[model samples]
Target: MMRKQTPWLALALLTLAPAALAQKTKVDAPPKKLYCWNENGQRVCSDALPPEAVNYAREEISAKSGLRTGEVNRTLTAEERAQAAAEAAQRALDKAAEDTRRRTDQAMLMSYRTEDDLRRVFNERTAIVDNNVQTARYNVASLREGLISLLQTAGDRELSERPVSAEMTQNIRLRHAELVRQRQLQASFESQRGELDIEIEDILQRYRTMKGSLPADSAPAATTP
Candidate 1:
């Protein structure tokens, strides 16, 4: 009975050998077509890239499933490439500028507590310039008085038929020069004050705008291209 069972087992093994070989063949088969293209209204497929695909649209198909993966993108022209580069550069510049502005706004908001804070600082800075202007004006007034006194003395000597001494002549020239110098200094101070006023106004306006829009607890943001 054991010998009879051994022969039956051998027969069963031989019968299963062909099926195993078939399964192995299927598994080891070459890859199927991965791409297809339309040629004169007919679909053509190949595992290798088609030579005529230079101008033809390529449709990528899965090798295992025979389904479309996606359509391949075409090559860009020189003009298209240049335009895209220009647009990308412009976008980068715009992003950089925006990031700088955001950081500036954040810094401004953090530095000052309120709109009045900006105003207070502005007044404080402008006050220094105002002080300079006042000092210059005072100097101008003093010089003008001295100039008038010297001119009157010169007139007295001329009326008395006395030759105006060289020393007196030199004194009058020096006084006039001092008066001109003080007037120029006054004008410069006035100009500087005006510029300071404009700067203060600009800074105040920027502060007001940033404070209105930015949150009190806003954090610095990272920028990306």
Candidate 2:
């Protein structure tokens, strides 16, 4: 399990280390049971002698851990260099993704403004569309009514020459023109709508690409060996 706080763990270890060091047991060799006196016939035994050096497990802890050490030390290896290169590449990828996102946002904002203006134009043109449709409908209704009256009067009489009245011929020509003009305006609106749709799709595609390049937010990989 992970510690809630490593600072406290370090402090506790430091506090115990001094006391453990003070508790070191001294080991020494006692003199011989019978020793000869210096240049005399008398014999005497000497007391114990002190140890050569102090002994404690905690004494060399700092040296082993590379703290307060001498010239001997470990150098950075090839594997460490590779790991540093990997980290630098990762940072570059992140920066590129961030820049892409910024550019896409600017493009989307411009597209949105353009769409708003186009939408207004579409609304205005669609109004003219409604008017054209109604006018076409009125003309068609009147033309059908006149044809029915003529058919009732002269059944099965083909009039390909079609020169009955000047006003009637002009009415037929004008109604045909109105219908053709309506189709043209409808086509115009559809063309503008298609271009607007493409711009919207392009903006969305860039957004998805930028989002896909982001790194996952899971656990980080261990870098220390």
CA lDDT, every model vs. true structure: 0.80, 0.51
Clashes, model 1: 0
lDDT of 1 by residue, 1-225 (tens): 354345877898899999999999999986575777777899878778856665567788888887887897656778989999999999999999989977977777767676765577667768888998999899889888988988888899899988888998898899889889988988998999989888778877887777677665773342322
Task: Looking at model 2, report the run of 10 residues with the lowest lDDT sum.
Answer: 52-61
Off by over 4 Å in 2: 1-104, 107-163, 214-225
> Residue 38 CA error for candidate 1 (Å)?
54
Off by over 4 Å in 1: 1-104, 216-225
Instruction: Candidate 2: count the clashes.
Output: 0
Compute the lDDT for candidate 1.
0.80
Question: How many steric clashes between backbone atoms does each model show?
Answer: 0, 0
Best by TM-score: 1
TM-score for every candidate vs. truth? 0.50, 0.29
